[model samples]
Target: MARSATTIRRSTLTVPVAPLGPENPLPPLLPRDDPHRIDPRQRATLPPDMARQVGYAPLTSVLPTRLRDGYGRDRVPTDLDTIVLENDRLSVTVLPAYGGRVYAMRHKPTGRDLLYTNPVIQPADFALNGAWFSGGIEWNIGATGHTTLSCAPLHAAVLDGPGGAPMLRLWEWERLRDLPFQVDLWLPEGSDFLYAGVRLRNPHDGTVPVYWWSNIAVPETRHGRVLVPADEGWHFGYEHSLTRIPFPEWRGADRSYPLHGDFPADYFYEVPAGSRKWIAAVDRDGDGLVQTSTATLRGRKLFVWGAGPGGRRWQRWLTEDGAPGYAEIQAGLARTQLEHVPLAAGGEVSWVECYGPMDADPTVVHGPDWAAARAHAEKRLAATLPEATVDAAYLAWLPLADRDPDDVLHTGSGWGALEVARGGYALPGTPYDPATLGPDQRPWLTLLDTGRFPEEEAAPERPPGPSLVGGPWRERLECAPGGPLTDYHLGVAQWHAGDRAQARRSWERSLSAAPSPWTARCLALAEAWGGHPQRAIAVSLAAAKRALATQGVDPVALAALARDMIPVLLDAGRADIARRVFDRLPQDVRARGRFRLLDARILLALGDREGARAVFDAGFEVADLREGDEILSTTWALLTDDPLPAAYEFRMRPA
Candidate 1:
């Protein structure tokens, strides 16, 4: 089969494992307290004041069996195990045993702020059956309150449809000790018009409540506006209580001092129990808005915090030394790995909150086509998904970020520092002053634009291909003025350099500036790079379809490209989505025999031995036909089921 002529047909390819949840060691839940650093030098960095303000305790502390009993610390309790909750609004499982806790917890104590905590087991010195375990403490109730407990170690918190079916987000981990198992839970299952969740499982499992507060740093611009519901709330306290601000809400408390900057903050609103209201911090000038909640918890309560842009608390912990923009749904946990709760022995905790979109001007929705916003999000989400084995490929890619020769591109340590390449793709890249791209770079830029360059010049004096961009790559993306190629290159470069924020921005801009099948591929890779495989799969399929209609491209080539991404996508928690996309492809595309070897590798994901054999058979028959490097290598490995062949090749081109 001619590789270029082969069409891609959707086919079912089951991912053996779910996407890997956030598993690496994130920054400590505590605030950054580098006394040696100074403002701008240390400005916007996580402050010591923020660290001291919030309480974070690891579960590693010897929890006398008594407290353990309260939190189901002993054997996984049967009550919390193997139970599934289903209803019209939502479907979920709560498994207390086998390291599976609540998938979605929604029942809030009469007067408690919605708080979700993971009950994890600190394994004994000697491994039990050579196993280490952890689980989630979550609850999901529909609008009517039907619930279930899933004990399958792989299933954790998931967002069913906004108003439809349940989407499973399983929380799982390998048997690695000394790493905190964490899980995130959104207080409200499906609230208002938006969905958000916070992963709060930290490795430490310290005794502290680990109260994390979110300060939505929304930006106001000339053409943008912030949107949030207009509702009443009580000022609980400043996110970082140490930040000096107006103390109108503080009765007799001494307010922290030396307030600076132009934007003055007012209150820390505390939403009371039974209050179903949501708030939004909007930038009328820029059209940016953050709809969030602020609540204070005493004993096992969830504390949700927020601050306006440029406010003390917002700038303190959120602002990084190199990157100043800060707007995220944050929590006070190191990872999403939760401790394994022993059956019904652990204390049961529930969180309740709602999310809604507020109209900044109420007429903005009517001002322009309101559908545009929804369409934008849907399109973006669609562009972020992949097909077939792409998810698995994504799952495999997550760990590689840690092992990446340029770890600064994808690790938390490299959150913001990175650069984009000329293709509008985010990849491991180096920061070069545009002014530096002189005659020497013309050859490279020409190749980047036309996808062709002299073979002789291809081998540059730099560190081989794509590695000589920078030394000690940045931890974030550093933006500069440039065109589509510049932005694209910058995005990929930042990703390669390990700056997620920069990568996200550059790729988003790349797609907007030039929405094409290639841009879709770039978006999918970026999502996979960020550890979101499901989204990656979705976008890949859309891109394939778009390419089919617009570019008259071969589907098998698309599948082959998609298949290249399966490992990383799987790592990002989109196994189901990836499988769905693969299954949806046309059958002719599957039998094209072009990506046949690659498809055979996908069989390993689906547990199809016959499929594996078929690929090998074809490989043997076509031994004389020169095959692409990826196809030849993948086929050889799948046929023999050996690890060695799979390891070799693919060093020259990125998946």
Candidate 2:
């Protein structure tokens, strides 16, 4: 592992991209917004500080970050902007426009891909903003789960790196916490490792809760084994519980292998203090990817989708036919992703990460004795890329962290530009150029400068636009001239800040000003999350009716609303009204897979089992199916004793 010559070049990666169709016009909301959110069962087992961080800055709302759930299943060949960093032994391709992900890392000597290069780009209902695809080395920042920037772009530039090689730096203003973060990646000459230096900075005047996870997806196989330093881990699943579990083997089976179990779960390795942090996924042949980071990223994890039908279905859904399954080996700032550590005012945390190939003895790694297996892998890691080298690389990259961009490689969201204009920040390395601001930020820019939200000429399809939930924006809205649009946006900002009572009042006043669907839906969400299900049902129904009555309304917007509201009615046993809502939908709108699925629920509620079964027999595909969604299987089971078809068999549990 000696330094040699390196190369950096800009290129395009053309793949079949299931185009992210559009931003859902509706502001996304949840049934409940839990502040200080963590599993109650975990309190006794966790350290107080880690428990506190888990509840810290629980993302109450995703206002400014609009939902990107509008992607479809159809894919077309698309060219994504990419930056290729090559050395004598390694080649790394980073997608500048797509969440600054390392799309592929090839070990030139073996001609191997060290990370899961998802054969296709298929967005699904994952990320905090709803559209997340599975693959690559994804830099997850903001709150827990996938970052809002998963499918979004990042500002990219080139700067001097180690050995005077060109470094690719991606930075942007993360809107949720109103923070700035940057990722600097480079290949040091002939070294096989790809080094990435990540920095998350809190620019605010007060403490802000921050989360960062470097998620690296590797190909999963029956013979694959994940090696981590820890002998114990915190296991979490869709069951909403976290429990202490021994490493490698859980219960009887060795959960280290992806196929050992049949349900998706997370095993967050409890790496002992002073241990060198690293995780690897090695196959039977002992050829695999290894990710190790400097001390700041103390947590390592193994996320498996498992061998269940749901997991398999999702695996195929995200990639092309015949592509292998993938599992994520992640490194983070906390023991588990459920926590968000607090970053002090004007404070910053930076660390370097190394990703490349590792060679191990397959027998010991896949052995029955967990301790020996783990120790053998650790020894190999220590020899391959010593802990000292990772630390040294981090230290060397620190001084060059703030070097201004010498060449702008790609443009990202204008939200950063707007933030720059508001704070007059002198962010050197990641310049938020004013010229990047576009129509999306124009209204907010107007609100910031003039304390007035620019309104469009009245139109049915023009619901209240996207929201700005920053404290400063909320204060500006509270002072702005009150109108339906202004008050509605103000309520959204308040809700995001965990001020439910104030948000409710603002929306009420907005609804009184103009009984619009947008304002009504916000108020209903407040009611639901406040434990007033009956009131919520009524308010949501009213909102749906209001939208239905409005002319020139975008059909897509109306469909999104019904898709959200009908479930509430059905959950409350008000299927009669839910049926009314469905009957009112335009034929084409009701024909979408999501609605047709809802239609089956209505039929089942009406005691028409045959009708429900017939709907399934007709065949359809839900493009935005969630990660653990088993509703199709549940509905199918309810319909009859017949086996659920392959297309509809996404049941992760043993039903």
Clashes of each: 155, 0
Candidate 2 lDDT score relative to the true structure: 0.84
Question: Whole-model Cα lDDT per candidate?
Answer: 0.31, 0.84
TM-score of each: 0.24, 0.94
The lDDT leader among the candidates is 2
Per-residue lDDT tens digits for candidate 1, residues 1-655, read 2212111111121211212122111101111111111233222443453333222222221101000100111233222334343332223333433333332322221221111222323221111111222222332210000011122133233332222233223233111111112232221232211223222222222321332222222332223322212122122222212222332223342211112112332233223344322333223321222233223211111112223232322232222233323222221121111111111211222222222223234344213443343233223222332122222322332332211121111111111111123423222212222433444345445454554432343211111122112211221113334445445555554554456587668767766765655556657766765667567767766665565455445443444445434544445554544455555556764544443544555665666768766656554211111111234554455557554332133211223
Model 1 poorest ten-residue lDDT run: 63-72
lDDT of 2 by residue, 236-319 (tens): 877667788987777898888978888788899889988888988999988898889998999999888888877788788888
Cα shift from native, residue 148, model 1 (Å) = 30
Worst 10 residues of 2 by lDDT: 29-38
lDDT at 228 for candidate 2?
89
Off by over 4 Å in 2: 1-4, 31-38, 456-458, 528-542, 641-643
lDDT of 1: 0.31
RMSD of each: 27.4, 2.6
